[model samples]
Target: MANVSYFEAWGMWFDGRSTPGNDLLGLSMIWWGRFGKILSFVAGAAVIVDLLGPSRLSRYSDRLTGFLARRTFMATAGASFVAAITFLWITDPIGMHRLLQSVLCLTFVTAAGLLVTAVSRALPATHRVIRAASRERVVG
Candidate 1:
């Protein structure tokens, strides 16, 4: 059994391996975990503020909420598709390979495209929030 150590800062466990790939994977996991936590907190706070505060925190003028929701759905669907394919391949690789040759591969490509588009849409919101917060910090 491999020994695992937990890192408080990263909020993750890591095996005692010094390999480059392991280090990179650990770092990426940490980054994603932190990013997700921060984003969730920010989004939750925004909702609370919008509900309770006299003035709205930030309002999107361009139907961005719908666009983001749609993009999020696409990304989620794409991820689910890929997950199902992975499970199918694990259960029956030969059958999965044959199916992939027919249509699964194309579907995988489409899912990847959706993921890319979703990522593109997601980044701007993060940047916009960061900019707004910085301005508020400076002004207030």
Candidate 2:
């Protein structure tokens, strides 16, 4: 018989629901889902470590710490936002579907804004190089 969709199975597993099925695909889904959780835990731990200050083992710890320290608020806010979304999504909170949808939209917009900001910051140096190269070609 047909089984639940992969994503559905993943969601079910995440929220402590029953397993997908007793088939190979269900086993695969469970394995990947558990792997995803492991990855998420590692990422969360990394963020916590970065927030708590740099490690002594890394050579570039000072520079990494400096960057993270400068944007601590932003980093914490973004992490909290992600955690909240994950919790709500898994818990299946009452009447939160619309909120989750809105949050998803906001996330896309925030990602776009960050992308634009990064591009804008890099453009000035790029433009200067292009201008200088063109001038050199024209003169030489």
Best by TM-score: 1
lDDT of 1 at 9: 27
Error of 2 at 9 (Å): 39
Tell me the tens digit of each residue's lDDT in model 2 across 1-140: 33566576667769997664423354554565688799999999988856654233232443445565566557655655665566557546555576766776567556655654564455555555555655675577
Q: What are the per-model C-alpha RMSD values against the true structure? A: 11.8, 17.2
Model 1 off-target regions past 4 Å? 1-94
Model 2: CA > 4 A from native: 1-96
- Candidate 1 per-residue C-alpha lDDT over 53-93 given as tens digits, one digit per residue, 9 for 90 to 100: 33233344124545655677666666767755775566465
Q: Would you list the C-alpha lDDT of every candidate in the order shown? A: 0.57, 0.58
